[model samples]
Target: MTAPSPARVVAARVLERVVSEGAYADLALDGELDRRGLSARDVALATELVYGTLRWQRYLDWILAPHSRRRLDDLDLGPLVLLRMTAYQIAFLERVPAFAAVNDAVTLAGRARKPGVAGFVNAVLRSFSRRGATEREPRPPADLVEALALRCSFPTWLAARWMARYGASEAEALMRALNERPPLALRANTLRVTRDALAARLATEDDIATLPSRYAAEGLVANHGGSPSAWRAFADGAFAIQDEASMLVAQLLDVRPGDTVGDVCAAPGTKTTHLAQLLDNRGRILAFDPQPARLNLVREAAKRLGVTIVETLDGPAEALAPKFPALCDAVLVDAPCSSLGVLRRNPEVKWRRTLEDIVTNAERQHAIVTAAALMVKPGGRLVYATCSLEPEENEDVARRFLGAHPDFALDPPSEFPVALDADGFLRCRPHQHGTDGFTACRLVRCRR
Candidate 1:
C-alpha cells in the first residue's frame, strides 16, 4: 500500500507526540518539517493542522464527543489525535477538502496498528463532516464564562479568572486574540544592522516585507510567514526572531553603553542578546541559567547576534548571590512563568497547563528573582519580568520581592518607554498592545 500523504501523516504524528509524549508542538513540528522536506505549501498545511488542532482541541473534542461511542479520553491516543486533527481541517481550514482530510486520517489510523481503529476513525470523520455544514454545533452552556471558554477553547477557570479581573467584554477580546496566529515578530540585531536597513534588505533581497514596531525601535513585524532563520541575513546575525513585547523588556533596564548587567534565567539568550544590542555590545552581560545545556543555547544566540559582551554563567540564580554580590549595575530577572500570555504562540501550553500550575510557578519565580535581587548594585535596578498574564506570577512576585528586600523600591513607571498600568508595571497585552502578554516591573536599590 502507498504511504499516507506526507503532510497529513506528519500533522497526525505531531499531534500524537504532543498529546501522548508531552512534546512541545513547535519543536516536534520543526523536527518533522526539517526532516520530511515537504514543499513550503505542504509544510504550511502540516503546521496549520498541528497548531489549529492543538489550539481548538477543547472545542474539537466537544464537537467529536457526540459522534463517537467512547469518551475522547477513552480512545487510544493515536486515533483520538487523528480525529481531532481531521476535525480541525473540516471545521476551520476552508482550503482543505473534507473528503481528503477524512481519507488521510483513515490511512494514518490503519498505520497505528490498532485493530478496527481505522474503521472507527473513518466512520466518525465522515459522519461529522457530512453534518458539520448543517449542524448548529453543540450549544455553549447557559453560563457565560463556561460558554466563552467552550467557544474560545480555553479552560473554564482561566476564562473566569480573566473575566473577574478584566471584565467580561475585554476578557473575551484577549481570548480571541490568543486563538489567532501571532504575527512573526523579529528584533533587528542593532549589533549588525539597523532596523530600517534590515527591513529594506529583506524586502529587496528576499521579497519579504516588515513593519516597524511602535513600541520597540529595534522591533519589526514580518509580513511573511515562517521563521527567517534560513535566510542569509539570519546567518549574518542581522536579526533575532523575538516578540516585540519581549524586545521591550530589555528597554526597562535603561542601560548605557557600558554597564554590568545580570540576566537571570537567561536560557537561549533571546534577551541577553537584546541587552547586548542596547549596550552596543560594549559592556559585560553575565547571563545565568540553571541548565548548562540551555546556557550553551544562550552562548550560541549571543554569538549569532554578534553580541560579544554577554558572558554565560552556567548555574542557578542562587549561585550568583555568593559569586557576584552587588556586582551588576542593573539586573534583569526574566523569571520562568506559567506562560499563559503566549497562548497564541504556543497553543499546546493551554491544553497541558492547569490553574494550580500558576500558583506553583509563582512560588518558584519569587525565589529565583529574590536570588537575582542580590546581584544588583545599590542605586542600580532589578527588573522582574514574565510572559504571563496571571497576577500570581507577575504582580504578586514583584510585590513580594520588594517586601522581602527592604533596600529596593518600585521604580516609577514613567522611567520606562512603554505604557504601564496604574501600578507602574508594564502590562503588554495581546489585545491592547498587539504583542505577547508580558508583565515587567523595575525596582531600584536604595543607596546607603
Candidate 2:
C-alpha cells in the first residue's frame, strides 16, 4: 500500500476523526495543524479547504452527483471529502486555479486509495471540469441551494419558516447573514478593570487590535491575527469572549449591587459572570443548568472572572422554580432555541439541525421560561433571551407567556440594539445588527 500525500493524509485523518470520534471541526483542524506542522500558507489552504467543503457540503454533493457513475455516498469518506474540497475551490476560490485544484485532489485520492480509484476521481473531475457551468443547469427561480445561498444558506424548511414569520426579504437577509462569519467580540469585566485600560494593556501585544463595542457599554471587539486566545487580556480575565448582542442581554437586565438573580440555562456562563460584574460581585446568583458537565464549565468560568457570588445547581428549572419562590430580584431565562443565528461560527449546525428542532426546542424553551418566571419577585424584572432569530422561540413564546401569566408585562429593553416592537421585546436579526442572530424579551412582574 502506498502512503498518502500530505494534503490527502491530513484530510483523510480529519474526516476520520470527525466521523469516527465525533470531534468538532475547529478541534480537528487544530490537531491536524499541529501534527502536519504546516506553514502559514499551507495551513490557510487546509483550513479553507476543510471548512468551506464542510459548509457547502449539500450543494457540493448536488453538483457531484451526476459526475459519478456510482452513487456519491458509496464513495469512501476520504475521496468524497476531497471531491467536495475540489468543487469548492473551483466555484468559490479565485486564487486557486481550477485545474490545479482538481488535479491535486485526484492525485491525493489516487495515492491514498488505489490507482484505479485515482482514475475514477480524475475522470469524474475532468468530465465535470470540461462541461463547466454549462453542465450545471440554469438555477431555477427557486433552486434550493441558490435560495439558501442567496437568502439564508439555511435548510429549505427552516428558511420557509423564517419567511412565514419575518416575510421574504427579511428571511433571505437573515439567512445570508448566518452564512457570513461573525466578528470576534468580547465583554470587558468592569469589576476587574475598565475596557480602555484592558485595551491599552492588550495593545502592547503584537498582532492584536482592539475596538469598543458599538452597543454594549463594556464590550470590545478584538482583531486576532491568526491567534485568538493568545491575547494577554484573555488570560487575565479582563474580558470574556461573547457576542456584542449577547452582552446586551446582561446590560438590559440592569443588575444592581445587592440584587439577587437567577440565570436558568446558564452554562459556559457568559451572561452569568456578566451579571456578577454588573452587581459588583455583591449579590448571590443561582446559576442552574440541566447538564452537570455544562454546570461544571459555568463554575470554572465564574472562578476565572474572580466571581464568588455564583452558586451552581444541577437540576431542571421546573423542579427548582418553587424552591426559590419569588426570591430573585431579576431572572434571566436565556432559553435554548434552534440556533439559526451564529451558523458562521458553527457551520455543522446548518446540516446537523433540522426544522423539527424548532418545535422540540420551543417546547423546552417554554418550559424553562415558565419555570424561571416563577422566581421573579413582584416588581422584579425577567429577561427571556435566545441566540435565535426564529419567532416561534421568541415572539410566540413571549406572547403565550404574557397571555398565560397576566401578572407579567413586557418591558421595553432600553439597552438592547435592535428595534423593539409595540409589544416591547428586542428583536435582533443578523442582517440588521451584524451581530449574532439574537432576540430577547424583557418582562417586569407587576406587584399584586
Candidate 3:
C-alpha cells in the first residue's frame, strides 16, 4: 500500500488541534483541507481519519492500555493522538493497510514529538497489530461506566448517563451508531428545484443515489458518494447539507406559504432556511440569535439559497417575545443543549459537557420555549426542538412550559412517519431513527 501523504500529516495536525486546543473539527478541517490543497479523495480520507479517531478514542485507549507502562492519561497527548488515529484505521477502515496505518502513525508522531515519543507510539501500535494480543476483557455491566467505556467508545460518565436514560441495549446501539460516519443528508430548495430534479442533476456521478426523505417532500438522502460540499448543486446552493433528523424539525413546524414564522435561536440558519423553503419565500420569518457572527452565517445562507423572506434579529430567544408578541403563525425554538446526540460529528462535546450542564441548559431551554410560545398567536403552532436526546432538555422542558402556560396544550398531528404520543411529541433516537440522537415536540396555543 502507498505510504501516508502530506494530506494525512495536515489531518494529524488538525486532529491534534481538536484534541489539545478544543477546536471544532468542521472549522479546523475546513482550514487545513484548503491550506493543503488536498484532492477530493484525500479530503475524504482526512475527514474519516480525524472524525473516526475522535469518535472511538475511549476504545482506542482501552486497546492500548495493556501495552503502556505509564498511565494512559499521563502519556504525551500528541503521540497518544497518533495511537488513536492508527487504532481507528486498523480497527475500522479496511481499505487502508495495517502496516501503512501503523507506520504513518509513528511517522506523524516522530514529526510532532521527540524520538522517544515516536518510538513509544510505534511500539504500542505494532503491539496492538499483533493478532491474539492480550486485552482487558469486555467490562462487566455492573460497572456501567466501565462497560460503556470499553463497549461504546465514550467517556465513563457520558456512557453511564445514557445507560441510565436508555437501557444498556439502546445506549450501546446509539453510541455505536454515533461512532460511525454520518451519511450526507440534504434538503432541496423547493423554491428553486424539486427533489427529483436535484437527484437527476446529481445522477451525473454514477456513485450518487438519493432516497425520498422520511419527512418532507423537499428532502433527499444523498448517499455517500463524494465530498458533499464539492457537488455542483451544493456549490449553487440548490440544497444545504443537513442531518435527516434535523430536516424533520422543519417539517414538524408544518408551516405553509405566506404564514408568519419565528425561528428563535436561529443561527447558521439550518432550520430557518428550511422553513423559508416550506413557505416558498413568501412568508415572513423573524430569525433571531444572540451572536452577530452566527446571524451573519444565517444571512449568508439565506443569500445562497435565494431566500428573501427572512428577517434577522440580534437578541436572545427569550427577548423576542417583547418585540413580536402574538404575531407569528408558528415559532420554532431550537434551543441549545448538551449536544450528546451529534457527538459523532463533534466529539469534543462529550468531554466538555457535564451533568450540571444538562440541568442548566434545560433551565435555559424552558425559559426560551416559554417565552417563544408567547410569540405564537392563539391557536397557532409552536415547535420546541433540540439535537439533544436528553429528556431534561426535551420532554422535561416541554412539560414545564405547558404547566406554566395554561393557554398552551399539546396538539395532535398524524403527519409524522415515527410514532408520536397523543400529545404530538416526536422523539427520535439514533437507535430508532437511523439518524442522530434527537428529540422534538410540537405544541399549539389554545384559542383564548
Name the candidate that leads on TM-score: 1
- List TM-score per model, in order: 0.97, 0.87, 0.94
Q: Which portions of model 1 miss their true places by more than 4 Å?
A: 1-3, 132-136, 413-417
Question: Please, what are the lDDT tens digits per residue for candidate 2 over residues 1-448?
Answer: 3433465457556755665677777788888888788666666677667666666666777777778898988888777877777877786687977778777777687667565788888888886776666565335446643565432335667666777767877777776676665687878888889999877877776556789988888888887455455566677788898998888788778789999999988898999999999999998999998899999989988988899999999988998887898999999998877776767666667777777788788888888999999999999999999988777788898888899999999888653455676767776667887788778878999999
Q: Which residue runs does candidate 2 get wrong by more than 4 Å? A: 1-24, 27-47, 71-74, 97-100, 111-115, 126-153
Q: Give one digit per residue, the lDDT tens place, for model 1 in 1-448.
A: 5576799989988888887799999999999998988987788888888888888998889888888988998988888988999899899988888988888889888887888999999999878998755582787689999898988889898899999999999999999899988888889988788999999989887788899887898989887545587777898889989998998889988888899999988998999889998998888999989899999999899878777888887888987666888999999999888899899889999877898899899999988988888888999998899999898998888888888889999996565557687888899999988899998988999999
Error of 3 at 435 (Å): 1.6
lDDT of each: 0.87, 0.78, 0.82
Tell me the lDDT of candidate 2.
0.78
Encode model 3's per-residue lDDT on 1-448: one tens digit a residue. 3456765787788888987888998899889887788877787788888887777777777777777777889877788777778777877777888888788877777776465887888888887877442443334467656877676778788778778877888788888888877767788888788899899888874457898777556778877776777788887888898888888888888999999999999999989999998898998999999999999999999999999999999989877677888999999989988888898678767767888999999988988887888799998999989989887888889998888889888775766767785656777677777777678888888897
